[model samples]
Target: MSETTMNTATGATAARGRGAVALTVARVVLALFFAFSAFAKLIAHESAIESFDRMGWSHGAMYLIGALEMAGAVALLVPLLSGVAAMAFVGLLAGASVVQLTLLDPVNAIMPTLLIVLVVLIARDRQDSTAQLIALVRRRA
Candidate 1:
């Protein structure tokens, strides 16, 4: 191959590699954030219970939600795990936001909306990471 052609190919390859790295880093950061939140809820058992009670859910349901959140947080760290956990949290937050609005309370909805947006950003980053992984695999094989 000509020298100029080789340099162009090299630059393209480097660019792709950099993009993939950036995406992976973003995913890792997002996964860490979700995991940390879940861990906090689990660790502060009493606080979670209190939160559930305040929300008007039965104590049993509160425990269940805490467990679910922990599970979802762990799932976010695993690649190719169907992303169900992340999706579940996203839905939960979105629903909470709507309920907050229905109750004619603004504060109840704002935080949930923020949380939902964070989840969506994580999901988008994850999707980009997955696409890059697939492309790399295809390039190799």
Candidate 2:
């Protein structure tokens, strides 16, 4: 090949490699973040309960959120289910962000940003279980 063509090919390969590295890094970071956040909530159940109470959620809701977080963490670690779990966690985080905003709760302002990132990562996984979830809902209706 000509020098120019070889250089172009080399650059393209380098760019693709960089993109792959970036994607892998992003996935690992997201996985670790969800895992750690969920573990923290599980390890500090009382603190989560107290915070939930202060936020005016019912006890049942508090327990439910905790359970979901724990489940999401486990799902994050499981390759077969990670995509679905990531989606669930994204929704949970988004809902919490909305509640915080509505209640004028400044404590979770950054949560929405994190949730957005999680949504992006989930999109990379190509599961699209959202469609299935919607279908299930429609069937019940």
Give a tens-digit lDDT track for model 2, residues 22-106. 6556656666766665655656667666777677877677656666876776666555565677777678877878777776476
Query: TM-scores, in order shown?
Result: 0.56, 0.63
Residue lDDT tens for model 1, 6-122: 999999999978865764565566557656656656566676666655667676665565577667766666765324445577887787787677644667689888777666655
TM-score (C-alpha) between model 2 and the true structure: 0.63
Clashing pairs in 2: none
Model 1: CA > 4 A from native: 1-33, 36-44, 99-105, 128-141
Residue 70's lDDT in candidate 2: 68
Model 2 lDDT-worst window of ten: 122-131
Backbone clash count for every predicted candidate, in the order shown: 0, 0
